[model samples]
Target: MPWSDHAIWWHVYPLGFLGAEPAALPPDSAPRHRLPVLADWLDHLVGLGCNGLALGPVFASETHGYDTVDHFRVDPRLGTEDDLVRLVEEARSRGVHVLLDGVFNHVGRSFAPFADVVRHGSASSYADWFVPEGDDFRTFEGHGHLVALDHASPAVVDHVTDVMDHWLARGVSGWRLDAAYAVPQAFWRTVSDRVRARHPEAWLCGEVIHGDYTSYVTEGGLDSVTQYELWKAIWSSLNDVNPHELAWSLTRHSALLDVFAPQTFVGNHDVTRIASRLREPRHLAHALTVLFTVGGVPSVYAGDERGRQGVKEERVGGDDAIRPAFPDSPSGLGPEGLDVQRLHQTLIGVRRRHPWLVRARPRPHTVDDTVLAYTLHDPDSGAAVAVALNYGGEAATATVPAAAWEPAAGDATPAAGDGSVSLPPYGWCVATAPTLPS
Candidate 1:
C-alpha cells in the first residue's frame, strides 16, 4: 500500500566528481569541463535501489551545467552516448531507471544560434530562434550571457523535437525540465505530446517550484513538477517543531491532490543536508518514513544516509556545505557511509516490497496530538497502509478508522484505550495489511 507512496528525490553535485566547482553554480552542474568518475557514480546509484534517478544538466554549460550550449550532445565529461547507454543497460538489468535534466529555457552565449544572432544582429538564419522584443533578445534570469529561445517559432520547434526524440530512443526514462516556470507552457505541451507518442511510458517531470503543477500539465508540457512551495514550508516548520506551521503543508498539498501526485521529497543538493534535520535518530527515521510512505516515490540525495551535512565551503563555490565529497565509508561520511547505506537499504527495501506504494492514493489526517498520520490505499491491490510519526520526545497516540491497517504487524503495540495505538518516541511505524478493492 505505501509502496505507491515512496520516492527519493536525488540531487547530485558534479563537484563530488570534478573535485572542483565554480562558486555559486547550482548542484547538478555538469562535470563536462571536468568529467567525474562516470562508472563509479553509476555503480553507486544502482547499489542504492533507485528505481528512477533524476539527473541534472549534463550538457556543456559554462557553470552549474545550467548554461547549456547544446541540447543534442551529451557532455563529453559525462561520457559518450555509449557510456550512458551502458549505464542504462546495467541499471535496467538491476531494475533502475534514469531521468536527465532538460534545461531548454536558456542556452550558453557561445551556442551556435546565439553566436549567430550576436554576430549577425538578427539577420542570421538562427536569429529568430530566441525571444525577441523589437531588436533585443531576452536573457534568462537576467544573465546577459544566456539567450532564451522563442519556443513558438517553427525552426526552434523542429530542433527541440529532434533532440528530444534522440534522447527517448537512447533508453532514458524521461526529463526534468529546468526553470519550467519561464518556458512557455504551449511548447511543453507539444514536447510532451510528441514524446509520449514515441515512448508511452516516458514520464516528464518539470520543475514548478511555487505554484500549482497541474496548470503546467498540458499538451507536450510535463507529467509532473517539483511541488516545492508546500514541502519547503513544511520542511521549515517541521524543522522548528512548530505545531502551527505543520498544517499549512498538509492542507495546501491536500488541496492539489486532484491535479498531480506530490513529488514528495525531503533534502536536495540545494538545501541543507537532511542530516541537519536528523537532530536525533528518530527525527531522521521520521523524515525517511514520510519520504517513503507518502503518496509518491521517495528520492535520495547522495551521501544523506552517511549523515553528510556538508563540509567547509570549497573554491568552486556553491552551498559548499552540501557538495562535500560523498564519503566512501561513514568516516568518509561524517556519520560514515556504511552505516548510512544500511539505513537506506532497509527503508528502500520496504518501499520496493510494496508496489502499491508506487501506485496508491493517500489521504492526510492530523489531530490535536503531536503526530501526523496518513492513510494510503491501492485500489488495484486492496492493500492499505497507515504511517504515523511522533516528533515529540514522549510517545503519542492517534485514532484511526476501523478500516485502517490491522495490527498483524509485530511493530504495533496495543492501544491503552479501546483500539487506538501510541507510537514510540521519535519513532515512525508502517502498518501494511490486505483489504478488498473498493
Candidate 2:
C-alpha cells in the first residue's frame, strides 16, 4: 500500500532475537537454524534506516511465539520451512519489509485444535474450535494456557483465512493482529475482507490495547491499530516532566491521523526499555523526536536501536526482560551499542527524509509543563516538519508558529527570525519548517 507510505519498522523478537530455547523445542527436535539469525541481520537491518522487518512470532508456538502451536508450522524452534523461506528471501533482498506475528485471539493449550479439544471433549472435531468454558475452554485473559478462539467460528473464519492466505503467499508484507482486542469486530471484518481479497498489499496491524481506535480501524477492516495511546503518551510524558502529557497525546494523535496511520512505537516487544523507560535518559532525544515527527507506521524495537535496557515485569520470565538476546551479527554490537546505533542512524535518517511523515498531523506549536511545540504539515506536499520538546532544567524557548526554521534534527538551536526554537536542557528538535498557513 504505497509501500506503507514508506514504512520504518525493525521490530524483531524472533524467539528472543535468535537465542531461542525459552522452552518449546521438542516436537522431535533438531532444526535450529535460528532464522538465519535474521538472515545475518540483513545488513544490520539496512544499516538501521529500517525499511521494515517487525517480526515477533514465527508460528508453531507453545511458548512465547504467542502460543500458536502451528499455524502451518515453522517454529521448529525457529528453523525449517526452509528457514522461513530464507528469511523471506533474505528480507526481500534487502529492501526489507516482513511484519508477521498473528496469534489469532488465543490458541496455545497445545493448540492442535486445542489439543483436539483436550482429548475429545465435546467429542471433538475441533469442537467448534473453542470457547466452551464449563465443560472447559475459554481461557485467554485468565491465560489458563490461552485457549479462547471461536470468533463466531465459520471454522474460525476458514482458519483465519487459510492462515492469512498461507502467509501472504509466503512473502509476508504485514500482519501484527495478536489479541487484536480479543478478536471479533465482525471477526476482523471477515478476516479483513478475506485478507484483502488476496493480499492486496497485506499490512493488517491490530494489537489494540484499549478500545475505539477509530472503531478498530473502521470496524476492523483494519490496516493499522496499535498506537497504544501514543505509546503511553511518549513514556508517560517523558517520565513526568509532562509536556502536558505529550500535549494531550498530540491531541489524541491528531484524531488518529483522521483515521489510520497508527502503528507507532517507542520501546516495544511489550514495554519498559526506552533505555529503561527514561526518567531522563536525556529524554532519549525526546522520544526519538516524537517518534520521527509523528503520524505513524513507525517501529524500531529490536534492542531499541541498541540503547537496550529492558524491564517489562509481571511474572514468570517477565517477557525475559523485554525480549533479550542478539549478537550473532551486526558485528556483534556493544561499544555501548554504537552510540545508540548512531542515534538510530540519525533519527532514521530523519525518517527517510520525511516521507510525508506518513500523514503528518501534529500542529500544537507550544504546549507547556516543560516545553512542547509541533507542526508536521504536508497537505499535499507543502512539506513541513518543526518539532521541539525540552523537559526543562534550564535553557528553553520553543516558539514554532513557523515563520522560518531550519535545523532538521536534534540538539536544537534555530533562532534566526522568530520561529524561536532554542531548547537546551534535555533538548530536541526536528526543524525544516515554513508551511503554516492553512
Candidate whose TM-score is highest: 1
Q: Model-by-model lDDT, in order?
A: 0.64, 0.82
Put down candidate 2 lDDT per residue, 109-166, tens digits, no spaces: 7777778877878898888878776857788888787787888979988998898889
Question: Model 1 over residues 1-438: C-alpha lDDT tens digits?
Answer: 222233344556554534544533454654343432433555566566665556666665665677787777656655556656776676556556777778788888878788888798768999778877666678887777777888888787778777777887988777778888887788888877777788877767777777556788744357677767645655555566653455556566655555556566677666667777545554676666656655554577766756667533435465667765543332333334576677677667666667556535556554444666666777766777766666677877754444545543224533423335577765556666576324
Cα lDDT for residue 13, candidate 1: 56
The best candidate by lDDT is 2
**Per the 3 Å backbone cut-off, how many clashing residue pairs does candidate 1 have?**
35
RMSD over all Cα atoms, model 1: 4.7
**lDDT of candidate 2?**
0.82
Per-model TM-score versus the true fold: 0.83, 0.37
